[model samples]
Target chain A: MTPKMNSVGVIGLGSMGYGVATSCIAAGLETYGSDIRPEVCARLIAEGAADASTSPAAFAGRLDAVILLVVSAAQCEEALFGEDGLAPKLRPGVPVVISATIAPADSRRLGARLAGMGLPMLDAPVSGGSIKAGKGQLTVMAAGAPETFDAVAPLLDAMAEKVYRTGTQIGDGAMVKTVHQLLAGVHIAVAAEAMALAARAGIPLELMYDVVTHSAGNSWMFADRMQHVLDGDYTPRSAVDIFVKDLGLVNATGDSLSFPLPLARKAYELFAKASEQGFGKLDDSAVIMNYVGSELPGTRDN
Target chain B: MTPKMNSVGVIGLGSMGYGVATSCIAAGLETYGSDIRPEVCARLIAEGAADASTSPAAFAGRLDAVILLVVSAAQCEEALFGEDGLAPKLRPGVPVVISATIAPADSRRLGARLAGMGLPMLDAPVSGGSIKAGKGQLTVMAAGAPETFDAVAPLLDAMAEKVYRTGTQIGDGAMVKTVHQLLAGVHIAVAAEAMALAARAGIPLELMYDVVTHSAGNSWMFADRMQHVLDGDYTPRSAVDIFVKDLGLVNATGDSLSFPLPLARKAYELFAKASEQGFGKLDDSAVIMNYVGSELPGTRDN
Candidate 1:
């Protein structure tokens, strides 16, 4: 008989992880949340998540599944294998659902390491922003052995609207997710580039956004990100640094395969430039600032 | 009093022009069609356009409006002022609607030249594609004097679903259209780049298409064009050379403004390369072949 995923431990209560934890709690799971920030932990508990201890090991063998939603693969590695990490405390064969966007090679290596220690690793990297995570509508591009998926099926159902079982190989989910980021990163870069050109060319930025969202040039990222640019609101829902890291992973993968990815590489450089200009912590759409710095285009009004 | 657009001449019956001509006829206007190609002219007549002579002078004085849907600014100028052109034959204040994608500077120059001939030039470049043109649902980014727009109102209504009267400046329509092309060209190029990356990364091409169309990575061009790439069909709905010219116009405008558009320029180079590889006449999505030419990425599949 398949085991039920009745209790869950969510690590890294950042924007995305907090939503995941809340959704799990809303679904009646005994959800626990932990972050390096104590306030974040307090906030999640206020939102109905079970109380979490400062040390990740507190939930150890109690978790039926662990959702790792940290910033990067390095953070994910530290959470699982670093001092006071959950690896030594969890029961053997409990599945770890990895949700960060990381390089496929790193995911494979981590999967191997975890498997060697009798843990089943589910390579699941999610798409959709935090908003979707809150609504339990995020798309999870996931892969692992059929039995491991069976073990965490209840948790997957609670957190995702569309779960693409990409392949059985633990690395395949990360592979597809990386490819998805290549497009997402490029779309945001092109959105900034195209919108700045329009603004400089004497079209109102708002008009450009309205026309484009209705035209063939429209993209999900363009529609979503450019709205933030149009609103002049750079409150970081997804920061520029996120693309910095994601596109960096893209470039590294292309390099490993000897593939030439000029556009994605160009997008990466733009995000890096924006990050350097001190817009790293702002919304990802603030990459537009790299093009229209210190003033909105087409006018000296600023 | 606003005069009805009783008779109109549509020059250059290409994919887009043919649609514009048929749509004009469908709107009950006496539409005359002309093309360098005899067969295209014949087809338009069969589609209910009025008969045409080899010379554009056939309906010159009879036309209340002339829709110039030719290839470029040069073609637009030639159709109006070239040998046996319609310039000398047109009466003063007859509005000529220019619907080709060209630089704003060129539009101003043409507007000035036509104004010298007593014609009220309406700088109108349309969006949506051939299908929308045929359905009379194109979006026209237009600019001219209010009186000229009033004079050409009937014709504009016949040809477009959305008519954005940008301003009274003759160059304004072309400016907005140029900006629109910047997005459209970059979107197509990036769509090819992203889809090709996914194809090479071991994701089945069709599955990648499905996941992306439903994901945040989706773009109108990606959803529309990648279908051609996936079907292995290169039947040109829109050719690569089209982007070559459009992006060249984008490059020229950016240069004139001293603005940096590295990504648009990069996309232009890829389309140019694809054209050089004998895919110029193929569909624009053939740009994907540039990446996956020698092999698909992971397995020795394709």
Candidate 2:
């Protein structure tokens, strides 16, 4: 069935955004794809995006929803309010679905700013990475007014397998997503530590993988990311830098509450170290290399 | 079919050992149980144990396999070699199935000591708690000679749902179990940390549990243990001291290899801190109190 939304623009056509735009097109929405790189726009258009442009003027008020699949809250603000942004051009009351993993406070602030401009906002942060995004199976932790949610239902349905209505409060979506990142980042870091312990203990990495995946020690992250470790492929399915940013947000949120997040802090430090050591751009499983001698293929030296 | 073994003894009839002994009885093996606590032995005898005695002499040579289900390698050694220990009384060629979580080196030493007495050894370390032990559904990570495995197959089947033949090499079972403990311990620590972050972030504790258990952040431990957190129950299904001990073994094993297990070390420290603060005997989820204000029901302050 055709999505009810007439047009939805996807900004930031990077790995995750690209899949989201493609999924929108697959669902028969009038999907407009934009990216900083003209080649990325051209690539999305070639793969069935209705149109590709850097300028928002072509769609303007015709766009029913804009999915801001950018990197952070700052990027979301710049995309919406910058000189060439869509804020002035988009029709009043059009919902902006913010899918970036930003701090909860920033989400609320951004939502309020958009609402001030007579635009409703859906504070929606996504999980399940790029592959899931391509399959239209990403999970959206969403919070906004019922009307805002209703307006974006078509777009969300096209891009997500599950859309959790966290609350009506603008930042609630970000709050849940932030909590998720805390666990995700921590699990990955600990997974790396567990693997490192296994490696250093002389346990066969394959056997370690098998046993852990089947045993109580298993986590979704450990089973998924450790495969990247086993393959020695550090290609960035999810980059280490993402955790560096996400866990930073986790710690900051905890700090605001005077909450002691000892484990999150340690995980953040590991990700920060990985980024500093130049493995930031690699798959996050490359954190395993920090513990084991750099046996992985994507080490900076290699 | 009746188990090939005539009589089997379970030493250290604590919560876990009592279950093992009962399961053996359920499987129609003649089971003897021993415990330091007379009441525990009395309880086991009431359940189904053929005999309950503090002395190993009650079934020593007659026990075709003795499942050592104590706390540590030291306890395993003491049970076997201490004055009135089973070592001197066990029949030659009877296999002593060592099911305690211990250092791989210690397992090897135990195996060697048993072999010196013409007794075979199965370095089998079990997972799944007392509940599973009672149902004959524990997972046994086992290593020993083929003959030893063949001879103990019926008993293994009787007591375990899955018995992984990790290797024939002595201590391989302990090696795998040690690695399992590394992940299990870290996952629990990080889970507590994540729950604390959520609790302090003003996300409702139940919501945090629901979202996390559904998200990629979920681990087997988190799903199982976070319920205790949600109920504010500190009843010890597994006490905090267990991780203190297990993670200690993990760190020690890593230390022996000069392997840097940074995450495991941090988790070990957290468990150690919880122990130091006198929550050692509380449920392991009490580690959450270390992060949040001590509002949980079983906090030591209360």
Candidate 3:
């Protein structure tokens, strides 16, 4: 049977959301975009989005599916259940895909609230960063009822290179994504830690990077993010504040389960420290600054 | 010019050492094997080693190169400079390759002592573990004098698939290797932490493993060691104590430089905790037990 998700409304015209909207349009779907930012909304409309209204409620009843690519569970909640919420206005049984990385409990609570309004919800979180999102090559970890998945198959196909079905339970995708953030954050922090130690010991940052990328010390984060450290660039490709939030969610999840996550806690603190030190708007690789002080390579007046 | 390293000796016959010995033999070197364990030495003798004496001093004067694959800097020192040491007996100017994971200070100290004895030294530490060691495919990070590396080129070629010339200073290789250990040890511990978090969240371990291996969360250690966690097989491919020691060296290196390594310190503590919990001899992935306690998957009796 053909998927019912023909027209899609993506809330939050941020990097990830705008990419999803454009990708959906590129895939021949009737895609609408909504954001508080008028300029970004106009950009999406220029990129072939059917509408770029700042509120999903403008066409909530006409959309076949809604995807929340907002920053947090709070924004997601505001978009779906607030005074001008789209959930009540949506067509009955239309799927709402929550693509933000949030606590599993928040995802489940959102899904439950959507269900009460005769809406199906998918807890779908995307990875591979904004660059991948723009290429329609994000990796999505999603969970929901089989029917919910079937309903949004077309939108998922349009936005992701790979979609992992975590389980039928709505929160399983968030659970997996939270655990994933634990690794991703810790890997990025430790990659910075390793490079910082190498720099202090007088090894050339470029040589250490080459050795590490070739050695068992290699990680996806180390290979991808350390380049920023080497280039002395901290332009917020994925800002330090993002990990501060993501890793905080990780530790919060562990706390909710009464499970201790030491590494995740440590990584969270490092990211938080980076953010507090005014590098929050810089690339997450700027977490290296937490260890390197002002002696970070490629920044010297050589 | 023909390389002077024709005959070679390997001290320490544990898994890594035995593999190094065999790889040398496989490459047509006249290899001598030494170990505290007689049976391992006998096995190397059967595997075509020219001699399998329990002491390198037996053939020290005749050997052109010696590789110490011992466990620690202390052991390396004892094997080279102890009462029955091999250093003074070795021919003048022969290259001594120290492959142990040690503090850069210890590596430098050893190189200095060897230099005083009219011997050139290469601070070369290896990675890729025993299985790769057996196949002559290990990666070696090395530093030394130009002549020292040239002298040991043939022996290095025999034992390693890749030999990174880190720099000319003796401890540079050890420093690079120590920084590498920070990443390797932390990645393994964090992999365990991530998997343990997934297990506690009721996500299937195998599925989490698959998702992580394919995602940006992937690390060489996570991809390699998480398998042991999935199979519930704590069969000591690389024991927990290895990290306890390696990460300990990582922190000590940081200490020597007055550089703080927070993640490495945390990872070292986790591995140490695993060791104290009697999982010391189990696979390094058993660091998961520090998080999972008795609820570890595959080990729960249905």
Q: Score each candidate by Cα lDDT.
A: 0.85, 0.85, 0.90
Better of 1 and 2 by TM-score: 1
Better of 2 and 3 by lDDT: 3
Kindly report the docking quality category of candidate 3: high
lDDT, residue B125, candidate 3 = 95
Residues A1-302, candidate 2: write the lDDT tens digits. Answer: 22357789998898899999999999999899878888888898899888888776677667889998999888898889988888889887788999999999999899888989999899999998889999999988888998788888888889998878888988888989988898899889888887777666666778778878887889999999988877778889899999999999988888877778777888899999988888899899887767766566323232
**Model 3, B1-302: lDDT tens per residue?**
43467899999988988999999999999999899988888889998999988877778887989999999999998999999899989888888999999999999999989999998999999998899999999999999988888888888998899999999999999999999999999999999989888888889888888889998999999999998877778889989999999998888888888898888999899999989988899889899888888566668751
Task: Give the per-residue lDDT of model 3 (tens digit) for A180-263.
Answer: 999999999999999888887889888899989998989999999999888888888889999999998998899999998898
**In terms of lDDT, which candidate is stronger, 1 or 3?**
3
Off by over 4 Å in 3: A1-3, B1-3
Per-residue lDDT of model 1, residues B17-115, tens digit only: 888888888889898988898878777777887777557776787888888898898998788888878878987778888999999999999999988
| Interface RMSD for all numbered candidates | 1.2, 1.4, 0.7
Writing each residue's lDDT as its tens digit, candidate 1 over A1-302 gives 54777899999988889889988988899999889999889888888877775677766878888989998999988999998889878987789999999998899999998998999999999998899899888999998999988998877887899999888998889888888898899889888888888777777777777777877878899999888777777888889999999999999988877888999999999999999988798889888877887763333442
Number of the top TM-score candidate: 3
DockQ, all candidates in order: 0.73, 0.68, 0.89
Error of 2 at A270 (Å): 1.8
Please report the interface RMSD of model 2 to 1 decimal: 1.4
TM-score per candidate: 0.97, 0.94, 0.98
Better of 2 and 3 by TM-score: 3
Best prediction by DockQ: 3
At residue A9, give the lDDT of candidate 2.
93
Better of 1 and 2 by DockQ: 1
